[model samples]
Target: MTCQELYIPKSLANLKYLVELNLSYNELEGEIPADGVFSNITIQYLVGNKELCGARSLALICTCLCIIIFIYWRCTKPTSLIPGTPSMKEYCAISYYELVRATQNFSESNLLGTGGFSSVFKGELSNGTFVAVKVLNLNSEEALKTFDSECMVLGMMWHRNLVKVISACSNLDFKAIVLQFMPNGNLERWIHSSTTPYLNLVQRLKVVLDVVLGLEYLHHHHHQVVLHCDIKPSNVLLDEEMNAHLSDLGII
Candidate 1:
C-alpha cells in the first residue's frame, strides 16, 4: 500500500498485524512521523521513489534523547562516499534462491563481466528488484574462503561509500553474492566506451578521490577495522547517477 502525507488513512488500522509493508515503488512524499495510534508499526518500506523528509530511531554517543533515529536509512545523496572495508556485511544481501531466478539459472546472456575468481551477471529477482550477481565456483577452497571472509566482514557494516550486498546464495555446487544494480556499469567500461562521454582529467581526479575516500572509510570509521586489499579501476563501478561502487574484494 502507498501513503503520502500527514494524515494517513484509518483503513490502514485494520492491518495492525501486517509484517512486511512494501510501499517502496511509490511517489510518497512528506515527513515520516512516529505519531498516531499505529506507532507500533515496523518494517515500513518507503524506498524506491519518494521525497521523504524525516525519520526517527538510533542514538549517538550521535544521540538525541528527545527523538529516536530512523533505522531504515537510505542514501539519497549524489556525492560518492569511500569506505575501505575488509569485510562484506556493510552492504545489503539477497538469498540464494532469489539469485537463481534473477539470473535464469546463470545463463550467459545475463553475464555482465567475468574475472579469474568469479563471473558477474545482471539479474532481476522474483521481487522484481534489479541486481548484480557474482558467482564463484563451488569447488574452489580459495573462493569459499573469500566468500566467508567477505560475509563476516561485510555483513556487519553499512555506508554509502561501500557497495551493498543484497544477500548471499549457496548450494553444494556453487555460491554467489547479490549486490545493488548499477545501470551505468563500471568505471572501466565508461572510461573506454565509444557511445559514452569520456571522463576528462577533472572527472578522473574526482573518481580517484571517491575511491580514496572509500578506502579511507574502510580503513577507519567502521565498527571494526577493514582493509580493501583488492583495489583497481575495474573493481570500481558507477551507478545511474555516476556515483562510484566498489566490488569484488577477495580480502579475508
Candidate 2:
C-alpha cells in the first residue's frame, strides 16, 4: 500500500513474520528500520521516496551519522602543537573522503595548477569554506621530501603576506595540504596575460612590497632563519582584494 507518511514507521520492524513491503511512491523522509521486511526488500520496493534513507535505500543513515561524527571530531579534537608555533586550533582536520567530495574526486575542471611534484585543486568544504588542495605525487623521493618540508615550515608560520595553511591530510598512500584559496590567482598570470587588466605602477609596487615583506619575515623575523630558494612571479598568489601572498614553500 502507498505510505504517504513523513517517516517509515518503526513499528513495522516489529512485524516478525512480515515478508514483503511496498512503501514505493511515498512521501517518506526518514531512516528506514533495517529489521524484518526492510532487510529482505529490494530497492525497487522503496522507489520514489527521495528523502528516505537507511537500510535498502540508495543513501544509508549510517553513512550520514558517520559523517556527522567525523566532523565533530575534527572540530573538537586538539591538534599537536609545534614547538614554536601558535595554537593550531584554527586548523580543521580533514579526511581523504571529505577532500574527494570537496573536489569532486579531483576532477580536471577543479585543477587550479600543476607543478613538477604536486597538483593544486580548488575545493569547497562542507561549511562552504573555499580552500586549495595540493596533492603530492608520491612516485619519487623528492616529492615526499617536499611534502614534509612544507608541513614543517608552514605549520610553524603565520603572516598576512603568506598563504595560510588550513590543514593537511596524510596517509601511507595519499598526502595533501589544504591552504587558503587565492581567488585572483598568481602574479605570473596577471603580468603575462594580454587579456587580463594591466597592472599599474602602484599596484606592481604593492605586490613587490608584499613579497619582500614575506621574505623578510621568513629570513629574519622567525625564530630560526628560513630561506626560500625559489622565488618567482608564479609563486606570488593574489587574493580577492589583489593582495599578494607567497606560496609553495615545499622547496625551502
Candidate 3:
C-alpha cells in the first residue's frame, strides 16, 4: 500500500493492549509519537518511513527544533524549513559519515569507476548488504544539477532491469546516492576481460532484451517522459545470474 500523506495517529499510543506494531514501506510523515507503541520500536519495524522523526533508536534526524533556533538567531526569512537532504519520498536518507565508514574512506580497492561528475564506490552496510554508492562532486554547479535530476527520475521509476535505489545522503559538503550492488559487474567488463568466456548468442540476446525492456518502462510506463541520454556497455550492469540492469541515470 502507498499513501501520500500518512501520519501515524497519536491515538495509537493509547492502546495498552497492543503488543506489536509493524508499519513499513509506506509514505509516513510527521514526528513519531514516543508514548506507548513507539517507545520500544526498533529500526526493522520502523524503516521505510522516509519522513518520520522522533526519539526512536533509528537515526531519524530530528533537526526541526535546531533549525528553528538557528533561524531565530540569524533573523532570516521564515519559509518552510525543509532540510537539505536527499528526497526521502522514495529512499531512506543516510548520513555522509555512515557512507564514509561503509566505503572505508572510499579506498582505491573499493573504487568501482569514475564518471564525469561523480565516482562509484562499493560499500557494505551494517547489516552486511552490499551497495553501490555514487558520490557527487559538490564543487561543480553542473554536477549538483545532475544529482538533483537523477534523484527526481530514479525516485519515481522502478523496474526489474533498473538498478535499485537503496538510500541517499546529501548535506552542504557531501552528496551520495546508495544503490543495490550488482555482483557480476558491468557488461563492458565481461566483454573485455581476457579470462572471461565470450557471451554466446543466447546470452547476448538476453542482455539486449533487458536493456530494451528497461528503456521501454522509462518511456511508456512513467507518467512523464524520461530520456536516458547515456546508454553504453559500461552503464549496463549484470547480476550474479547474468541478468542485465541499467545504471548511471544522472544524465537521464
What TM-score fits each model? Answer: 0.60, 0.65, 0.63
* Model 3 steric clash total: 0
Q: What is the lDDT of residue 198 in candidate 3?
A: 83
Better of 1 and 2 by TM-score: 2
Candidate 3 global CA lDDT score? 0.77
Candidate that beats the other on lDDT, 1 or 2, i.e. the better one? 2
Where in model 3 is the C-alpha error above 4 Å? 1-87, 250-252
Question: Which residue pairs overlap in candidate 3's backbone?
Answer: none
lDDT of 1 by residue, 39-100 (tens): 54332354443454444222111232222232111222333434464345344455676677
Record all residue pairs in model 2 with backbone atoms less than 3 Å apart, i.e. clashing: none
Any runs in candidate 1 off by more than 4 Å, and if so which?
1-95
Tens-digit lDDT track for model 2 on 51-106?
A: 88654564434544655685565435443223445534456799999999999999
Task: Please give the CA lDDT of all the candidate structures.
Answer: 0.65, 0.81, 0.77
Error of 1 at 210 (Å): 1.6
Output the lDDT of residue 203, model 3.
74
Off by over 4 Å in 2: 1-90
